[model samples]
Target: MPPADIDIERATTDDLEAVADAWVRLARNQANHGSHVLADPNRETMLATLGAYQVDGGLLVARDRETVVGFASVTVERGSLALDCTRGLLSNLYVEPEYRGRGIGTALLEAAEDELRGRGVDICTLEAMAENESARRFYRQAGYDSFRIGFERTL
Candidate 1:
């Protein structure tokens, strides 16, 4: 599908529930790699996180008409040891499975870059699980280069 038909906009407070639902879906897809998964988030926590994103002002969503096809979150933060501190983090990016490969992800990433650049963010960064080769390729094609190795050991 052509991306021109899709409408992309910043998410509002009213979108909190939808955003939370999307987050949960994406999280479930993540590897269990020794992290606790909460089945439900209380209203207060959900509202607080979504509210914080709204205040930070960088959540963007792509909608095919009224249905949100994909969403991404961008934020400027002090980068960790490997990432550049001057860059904006592409914190979260996900598309509904049905919407994959239709340019929704591309549009979302472009939107994120626009928002980050508007804020004087000269660089952008994101991380994907090493096991997710598709995600790594997607990021690489989107102009991200791998610069650091991530390591973890269970104690």
Candidate 2:
């Protein structure tokens, strides 16, 4: 649970497989926080997508010794509005259940934000499951606030 227990670093191409696997787990976790059936991502497609953005942004990983315990996908994206504002999307941030209480998540998040800032992003946005109170609390503590509400229904 201590901040010094892990090291945060930018993931390299060699970490492709691990990043993909972690992404799958993060999708499952989000689904668990809400009522929904989340489909598995196509590994090949996901890998290419994550890999493609390496030049602009990247996957930041939290490592315990040589083992990766958590990761976050940071990317630059255009804001929804027509205005020309640079937006950084915190696409995914995941910490294994066993390491949830540690400072790993916070470290990865801060690192991702710092990376975005370095890239000239004017603002960064992240979303949490509407019903995941703890996640909401965590994001709030991480300097995020709610500005939009999304509605969805199973078809």
Candidate 3:
């Protein structure tokens, strides 16, 4: 599959539950790629979060005639009272393993970026699992350059 045929759109309220389910699968996929796992991710919580985000951000989904192939979650980062919201962050962009080569991820990402740009965002930022080489390559091809290094240790 090429990168020109995926159907991407903004998720509506009716798609809430389904989007929450997709978010869980995304977390699991990240875990599979050696990232941290959500031991008990709550669907209700995800729905509520996304619901609120629907007002402040935009949730995008990619589908192939009904089945959700992927989704992207984006929000304009609100700065302090002294600053403005000119930065957007793509918090998550996930595609199913089976749909990885079908252009779905690219579509979702592009849609989110466009959504942010429409809101006057000057820069878009996203974080990929350090262990997920595929994700790194994807963002790189999407024109993102590394600007930070994250570190942590068990306490």
Candidate 4:
């Protein structure tokens, strides 16, 4: 599908369920790339999170005509008082599997950034699984670089 066909707009209360569904799919995909999340078990939590995002006007949906094809959720992250900049966190981004590579994800991401910028956010941050090379590459192409890296261990 052409990029022009996808419409990126703020998500409404009516979109919460669809956004949660997309989030679940995103979690399932991440699980294959080293994420430990349990998607199905977290449906209610995801719904609540989506509601919060909606309340903050940080939930965006990408629609191809009347059908929602993807969503991006963002939030302002204020660190300790010692931090230099308030960051806009791209908390979640996902496009339907069939919509991948059609520029929908990029549209959603850019829309998210614009939403943040409108709120006076000059910096942004997001996390992708270490093993998800495709996601890393996409972020790099979008002009993002890693300023922090995390390591985890299981006892």
Candidate 5:
């Protein structure tokens, strides 16, 4: 599909279910790449959060003619101690596997950034599972550098 075919816009109450479904798929897929999140078990929590996103205007959905094929969640966060400016968090960005390479993900990402920038956010942060090299590469190519690294050791 052409990039023009996809519409990126803020999610609505009507889009909550579709957005939640995409988020579940994203979390489940991340498990294969070192994520510890229990996607299925968190469905209720995720759904609740989507409701909040809707009201906050922080959730975006990418639709290919009324079917949501991708979505991104962006939120503003207050800095913790020592920091002066607020930050934008790109908490979620996912494009369906079949929609890969169609530029939908890039469109979603750019829209998310623009949403943040419009809110006066100058810096943004996102996370990609360390084992998900493809996601890491995609973010890198989009001009995001490694600002922090997390290390974990399971007991």
Candidate 6:
């Protein structure tokens, strides 16, 4: 099937439910390796989180017709080790499983980059599980170069 037509736009208050559902699906997919299971976030939490993104001017959504097919959230933060004064963090980037490999993720990332650029972000950064080679490859193709390795241990 041809890729579904996607429309990228700013997420509104009314999009909270769809955004929350998308987050759940994406989180589950990301944690599919038996690493950990995340708790389902409540609608209020979703609203607050998205509200923060809006306040920071960093939320964008991709829609297929009236349904939200994908979304991304970018945040600007001060750089420590990097020479750049500020960098954009891809806090979240997700597309519905049915919508995967259909350019929706790419479009969402591009929209995020554009939004960050307009906000004076010099670099874009994101983290993917080391086991998720596909996500790593996608980011690499999207022009992201890994600068540091992350280590985590569960207590």
Q: Each prediction's TM-score against the native?
A: 0.85, 0.86, 0.87, 0.95, 0.95, 0.85
Evaluate residue 86 in candidate 6 and report its C-alpha lDDT on the 0 to 100 scale: 70
Computed on alpha carbons, the lDDT of every model, listed in order, comes to 0.78, 0.80, 0.80, 0.90, 0.90, 0.79
For model 3, the superposed segments whose C-alpha errors exceed 4 Å read: 1-5, 37-39, 81-85
Error of 4 at 113 (Å): 0.7
Model 2, residue 81: distance off in Å is 5.0
Give one digit per residue, the lDDT tens place, for model 2 in 115-134.
99998898898888898898
* TM-score computed on alpha carbons, candidate 4: 0.95
- Per-residue lDDT tens digits for candidate 5, residues 1-155, read 22888888999899998888888999999999989999989988999998897799999999889899999998988656666776899999999999989888888999999999999998989999999999999999999999899999989
Model 6 segments beyond 4 Å from truth? 1-4, 34-37, 41-44, 78-83
Over 4 Å off, model 1: 32-47, 78-85
Task: Judge candidate 2 at residue 17 and give its lDDT.
Answer: 77
RMSD of each: 3.1, 2.4, 2.5, 1.6, 1.5, 3.0
Clashes of each: 0, 0, 0, 0, 0, 0
Error of 3 at 81 (Å): 7.2
lDDT of 1: 0.78
Best by TM-score: 5
**Residue-wise C-alpha lDDT for candidate 6, range 1-155, written one tens digit per residue:** 22547788888877767887877777777677433647374445766787788666687888888898888988887655766367889888988878888888888888898888888888888988788888889999988889999777879
Write the candidate numbers in order of decreasing TM-score. 5, 4, 3, 2, 6, 1
lDDT per residue as tens, model 4, 5-96? 88898898988888888888899999999899999999899999899999989999998888889999999886666567767899898989
Candidate 6, 38: how far from true, in Å? 1.1
Q: Is candidate 2 or candidate 6 better by TM-score?
A: 2
